[model samples]
Target: MRFSIYLNAQTPGPQEDVGIIQTLARQAVEATRAGFHGVVLTEHHFSGYNTYGDNFMFAAHLASQVPPGTKFSLAVAVPPLHNPMRLAQQCNLLDILTGGELIVGFAAGGSPLEYAGMGRDPGERHAQMAHNLEILEAALAKKPEDPPLEWETAFEHGTLHTRIMPSAFHRQSPAFARATQSDSGAEWAGKKGWYLFSAREKPQALAGRWRLYKQALRAAHAEEVVQDRLDWSMVQKQVYLADTSERAEAEIRERLVLMADNQRRSFGHVKDLRDAAHLKSVVGVSPQNPDEFLDHAMLIGDPASVREQIREYEAAGIRHMAMLFNFGFMTPETADRSMRLFIDEVLPAFTG
Candidate 1:
């Protein structure tokens, strides 16, 4: 099993922005020094949410500081809003900078405003993403195969007589992953033979998605995938460990619930959708009603109990757990305390 720290960049406001970034930089180094092998980030825009902002730049910043072995990933970069050719360029360039330690995931999940603000129609995001993916595949393809690459999309049009510069390590694109909360998306990801990343959801719901992905994955071609990659995939959760369950619950209800309220502010109309339950923005957060959030969304408990909970996931074929140890405006000191304990007592049980 593998564990990674999720840097939830829900900052309070602009006042403490520098402090937050510094804290995250330190946390990344600390996690790498510990047993955690990956650092996960998310992308959002204009919402005052996802405060670290540019995932690409931020990841590069971390790469300079963390050990060479540490991997940097954007769990799901919003493809609908980006020009496909540029996106592909960024991937290969960043992969080179990180010594081929970057893996990218894509999905069409984001708030409607995020699309509208970018002069896009939210309703068309799925189609837009599909179009972008087609172009991206062409952009990432190596030479000696096709004629000059010409592509068109709502936001971009380009003809590549020449190849993307600074070719990725070994002239291959970095390994790709896909994040999905929909049945169709799961099947599509499998057919592409990309890695899978699951958003927070009920265990049963996740299991169903996994089944679809796993079945399709086996039917498709996985040229470089290992058995371990098949088992782990990836899943995200808000996690906290303490000496007692009571203490963990109390702090989560206070901080995480408060974080939910802050998230709601940025979430805006998206929070009111009938099917918003699956929105990655909510992360299964329930404001004021922390018990509901606790029951459904996160992994919160004492170290021993948290270990037991993780055992359930491992038994169910989960080998890589992406855990959010900080978020919702939780103080860095407090978050570090929880993370350090997990590193000391809980992580070894599995990683060892």
Candidate 2:
């Protein structure tokens, strides 16, 4: 399996945000040097959910520093928020910059505030995303001689008379991935022979998603596409490494609670993850209750145990693991220690 770091940082307040963002940037450089195969980023805006709101620009900056082999994924970007032409141009340019080592994942959904900030209606996001994506595909496929497109939407409309300049480095346009928590990720992306990923899911439970996607791909695509797309599937986790499980748990205990409280305040008890009542009944842990959330949502242990957890994920068809080392108000220095330990001890078990 190939492992990568998911570069996401939390903001406790405006006071602490700047330092976290700087740390996150340095962590990207450190991770590439530490021998991770790739890196993943998510696009979040307005709420400080991601320390940086501009993933495309951040990725371009990273491409200059990370090793040539260090691939990148936008794991996702919200399509409805961008002008289609600009979005297409940005994706193609970034793809060229990465030497075609880019996967542009997209989803229709985003936070309501983000939609509002972009002057897009949340209720119309799906339609808007579809419209934007169609334009993007058309723009990517356009040749200089092609006729102009006349596009209109609720918010804006324009004509595109020329092909998107500086075409993608890849011959067949950039590889596309979809981000979704529902079966649609497989039903659409799988059948279309595209990559798909999800987060906040149990690694073991992802076996179901894997099976469904494989079934869908086998039914719709040729052998080469099926074989190539089948491997390198992604799984995300929050990771912390220590000499012993006891030490790992004790070190992360308070931080997890603080993170959970943010989730409760930001997302209203994180009902989307699961309400307190159902979470307690099914998993014996509330969404904001960090006591057992650590066990369920994170990968925390000694190097040996961490390696074993990764092995389980591999058996379940996860070839790409995107781990988050800094989270829940954790210090950069502390997270880097875990990352370096992972590189020196745990990674060799998998990589070598």
lDDT (CA) per prediction:
0.77, 0.77
Which residue pairs collide in model 1, if any? none
lDDT of 1: 0.77
Scored against the true structure, residue 258 in model 2 reaches a CA lDDT of 74
Q: How far is candidate 1 from the true structure (C-alpha RMSD, Å)?
A: 2.9
lDDT value, residue 287 of candidate 1: 49
Give candidate 2 regions above 4 Å deviation: 267-296
lDDT of 2 by residue, 185-287 (tens): 6678898778877666676667888888888988998988887776655767889999898999888887777766765565442334323223222212343
Model 1 vs. true fold: TM: 0.90
Model 2: lDDT of residue 319: 79
Per-model RMSD to reference: 2.9, 4.0
